[model samples]
Target: MFNSAVATLNAPPVSIVLNWKSSYDGANGALIDMSQAVPGYSAHPDILAALAKGASDPALARYGPVEGDPEFRSAYADHVSQLYNAKIDRNEVQITSGCNQAFVATVLALAGHGDRILMMRPCYFNHESTLGMLGVGIDYVDCDDDGGLLPNCASIDAAIGPQTRAIALVSPNNPAGSIYPAPLLADILALCQKRGIWLILDETYRDFMPLDMDVPHHLFAQDDWQSSLIQLYSFSKSYCLPGHRLGAIIAGHDVVAQLAKVIDNIQICAPRVAQHALTPMLTSMSSWRQENRERIAARATVFRTAMDDLPGWDLLSSGAYFGYVRHPFTGVGSRQLAETMARKAGVLVIPGAFFGAGQDGALRFAFANAGRDVIVKLADRLSSLTL
Candidate 1:
């Protein structure tokens, strides 16, 4: 027999296969894959060389510091300090296998069985399942579709209850791509502080935000920022290293110390080879990374322009790597539509319903993985369909 919590998210699978199994006759079009949230590009040549060198050197095969390699940790801490203008030390950062593992550690650290964590509806499916499998009830704040999927502050304020232990949110959100404004974030933090709950802010797409946008928060500069905030990020998107399984957790030293225990049990430590390889890139390839950011931003623009006024299609929210669009089929379930799309339209995308407690009308497109040339085809693929 399966666990009850497992049954909750057993609700449905992403099913790129189930979709293609039926209609993949090699007829309509070659598959346009956009299912997974991974970098479609290659890793840095220097890092690839480093990985090769590490493979041959006999040095990187052993266990590493559970918190992380000191060199990589110090390098990343310095990187964080430079970006946020906050004086963070290596002691405040913990490397994990990936951002997913980082989220697991933070959730395990903050809440447990029968406890609850508030998240916005139409969330990252992984976040939803993580809580479901852990027996942590997910409390969802309904996102404002007309208002660009941003959570209404009052809803978050209203969602908190005695059983709520924390609030976790992905900014430049996975399905919606809505970036929380500074004032809105401050209010959320204040709300969390007043309610005595932790705030797990996932900034995985921070590197992809527009160059002109401000950093996500001022809390990094606060004296007690560590006490109330747990920040998560991925080196994968920024450095094209998801396969290397490297991510970092930024929290107060005490929280970092506790989560280190969970992380130690999780993956021993993050991939040290990748961590070390990224240190130099963080310092040396600023221009390349910024250029990559611009490239992804351009991809988002392509999706926006492509779907601008298609009948019954609505681009409700877009930013970072994702764009949430309302599908024209008003009565079709999103899960069914997602499958129909993958099979019929030759495009793979995540259903919005995968995101949260209530998401019936939208589908999420992570358009950044496609290059400009490939992105050009999306308009046609979308236009060709009559869902």
Candidate 2:
């Protein structure tokens, strides 16, 4: 027998979508995979060398601190402080196997069965499934395409119920890629404080924002910001090291102490080699990170231009690594259309239905997985879709 909560859920969306590839015979063209938000390029040579060096060190094979390597934590703290223009103590940071685990640990620490968490619709599927498995009820604030998929402050305030423990948000959101404005985030934090709930903000795609944009937010600068705010970030995307699976949690020291218990049981510590490898690179590779940021931004421009004036498809919202698009087929479900595109058109993407209910009319394009040339071919491939 399996746990009904998890057993009842659908298979992982990426794997499900990828299975349709078996039907493709390279008839259209080389398969342009836009299903997962993997970096289109290779990891920097220095990062790879560091990873190799760390792997060769026998000391790193053993377990390290449950929270994370002390040196890595301190380096990451300094990195965060510099970016946010605030002081973040190393003690307040907790490293996890990946951002997904960081989210899981935060949920485990903050909520339990019968408690509810408010999330925005078109939410990250992993977050939703994590709550479902833990028996935590989830309430969603539906975001409209017209609003660029940003949740309304009034709606968020209204959605907070007596049992709501925290509000989970993803900036440069997973499916929609809409960046939440700094002012709007502050208002939401104020709402969270007034309602006596936690604000779990996930900034996984923060490094890929438009180059002209300033800091993502000033929440970290506010007095006692740690008491109400817990921020999550991923090193995998920025470093192009998803295989290493490293991530972090920035919160009050006390919160980090509490999450340590969950981390101890889930993963004794994050990948030791990864921690040691990335610790120095956090500061040393700033220029490389900035260069990749520009690369991703340019890809976004190309993808946006490629989607323009497409007969029936509408690019509802796009930025960072993804584009949420509305397909023109009136009655066709997003999953069916995505599958068809993968098989006949040689393009792979995720169906919006995988994100949440009422998203069946749209699909999520992880444009960062393809280069400019491949992205440019999208229009032709999509235009070829008759169904």
Candidate 3:
């Protein structure tokens, strides 16, 4: 029998959204799928070659260190050190199957049954579900449209209870796509330190942030940062290799040692083939990553323009890979609207209700997978909807 906590949860959002596709008859046009946040483009040729070479090698098929491949961890540590202008040792890094697994391992290592983690409303669903199945409590502070969907440090500070073990957040957030400013992040980190709780920052989409923004934050450079901060990242979006399922955690050496126990029981180690293939490419693929960043930025601009002055749709906060939009129907729930849109308008998106409560009027459009032309056509499809 399944656990009640896990059994009571809603089905996976992406899988539910994809199932709606079965109702579409293609009457409107070619389906524009803005549901899942995957890179629209294919992996780089060099990366593909590396994967093939690594997969074919017999040695890479053996078990690796529970933390990760040594070369990959060192390569990633160097990459993080340069990016954050901070000192990071390879020993402080732990690679996992993906960012989701990274979160699971971090939670298992840091908190337990009845311990709470503070999260923003409209938080990533997977984070919520992960906590639920573990019997961990979740406390939320709402991030509204007026505040650009960023949580206030004072509000977060006030929400922390004695049992709260950590504050988990996603930058360039999943459903809202709102990037937290460095100063804001610093303020929140200070509050977390003051409260004696962990700050789990998920930076999965950091590589696609607008080019003009400064470094993500200076928290990594602070003395004793390792005591309170844990940063999570993914190689999937940046490298267009989600199927490879590679992610990492950068924390204190002690924290990494603790996580090794959790990860050892969870995965033994991340996929050896991916670790071997991506180790050198961390440095080698710099320019390629930058180019993709520019491409995503261009797509964001086009999406904004396409949504501008639309009769009912309001583009709330958009950047990175998503546009959080308020739909026209006032009383209709986003779940129903989203399904109707897919079947009639041939446009697929995730309902905001899936993200959290009080989100019935909104939809999360992951425009990263749609090209500019496809995005241009979105306005018309949406406009034609009568239901």
Candidate 4:
């Protein structure tokens, strides 16, 4: 039989959207998919060449170091430290199969059946479900819709209970791409430090933000940071390597050691070939990656313009890869409405309810995958929606 997490998640609603996308296939209808986190583009050619080299090496066929190959770990730690100006050593980082695995390891490291984790409402759905399946209590801190879905430190402060073990937040958030300003992030970090709880910050979308923006939160540079903070990341977005599935967690060396124990059973180690291959690129291909960031920023501009064309729909918050839009619909649920739109409008999207129950009034459009022309079609689709 399947587990409770499997039951609760009920398969990502994107699957249902995909089914509708399939049903509506036609040469006449436009197909713009904004449902999943998958990158619409491919990795750089030089990166592929490295992958080919790694694949052909007979030495890579064998099992790798469970902590991650030393070369990759060193490269990752150094890159993150230099970018964030955080003092991190190779021992403080643990490479995981991907961001999901990094999150799983962090949860396992910190909480259990009866312990609690505070999550912001309209959170990434998988975080809620993961804690639920573990029988860990997930308490939601209500975010103000008027202010955008950015986490308010006071609400977060109110959510911390005696049993609370940690707080989990995703910046350039999944459903709402609202970037929490550095001051707000610092406040949350201070609360966690005061309460002696962990702050699990998911920075998967951070790479897409304007690189010159002020700090990506100063939690990393704070004194005694490792004791109260655990940061998670995915190479999937930044490196355009989702299928390769490589990610990492940076915390105290002690916490890293604890997660290493969990990783022992969950994966034994991250995919050896990908980690080994990504090592050199992390160091050598900085400029290429920056160009990709600029490209995504351009796509964000196109999406903003497309949303501007659709007057009835409200473009709530656009950040990184996602645009959280409030459709003009009133009565119908987002799932049913999204399904109808997917078929009729010839575009696929994830309903807001999939992200969190009370989020039904909105929908998430992962606009980064589609280019300008494809995103422009969103206006037509919005105009066609009956709701």
Clash count per candidate: 0, 0, 0, 0
> If scored against the real structure, what TM-score would every candidate get?
0.95, 0.99, 0.99, 0.96
Off by over 4 Å in 1: 11-22
lDDT of 1 at 332: 89
Lowest summed lDDT across 10 adjacent residues in model 3 is found at 307-316
lDDT of 3 at 94: 98
lDDT preference between candidates 1 and 2, better one: 2
Taking all chains together, the TM-score of candidate 1 against the true structure is: 0.95
lDDT: which is higher, 1 or 4? 4
lDDT tens digits, residue span 56-159, model 2: 99999999999999999999999999998999999999999999999999999999999999999999999999999999999999999779999999999989
lDDT of 1 by residue, 1-387 (tens): 878777655544555434455575545567777766777788779878877777665567788899998988899899999888889899999999989899999999888888999988788888888887888888888887777788877889899989999999898788788998877888888888888998999999998887687576677886688778999999889888778888999998899888988987777778867876777778898888888888888888887887774666899998999888888888888878877777777878887777765687888888887877776677777776766
TM-score of 3: 0.99
lDDT of 4 by residue, 158-206 (tens): 8899999999999978878889888888898999999999999999998
- Shift in Å, residue 281, candidate 2: 0.5
Q: Candidate 1: count the clashes.
A: 0
Better of 3 and 4 by lDDT: 3
Clashing pairs in 3: none
Across 1-387, the per-residue lDDT of candidate 3 in tens digits comes to 988999999999999999999899999879999999999999999999999998999999999999999999999999999999998999999999999999999999999998999999888999999999999999999998899988898889899999999999999899899999999999989888898999999999999888897488899988799999999999999999999999999999999999999999998999999999898999999999999999999999999999994777999899899999999899999999999999999999999999988989899999999999899998899888978
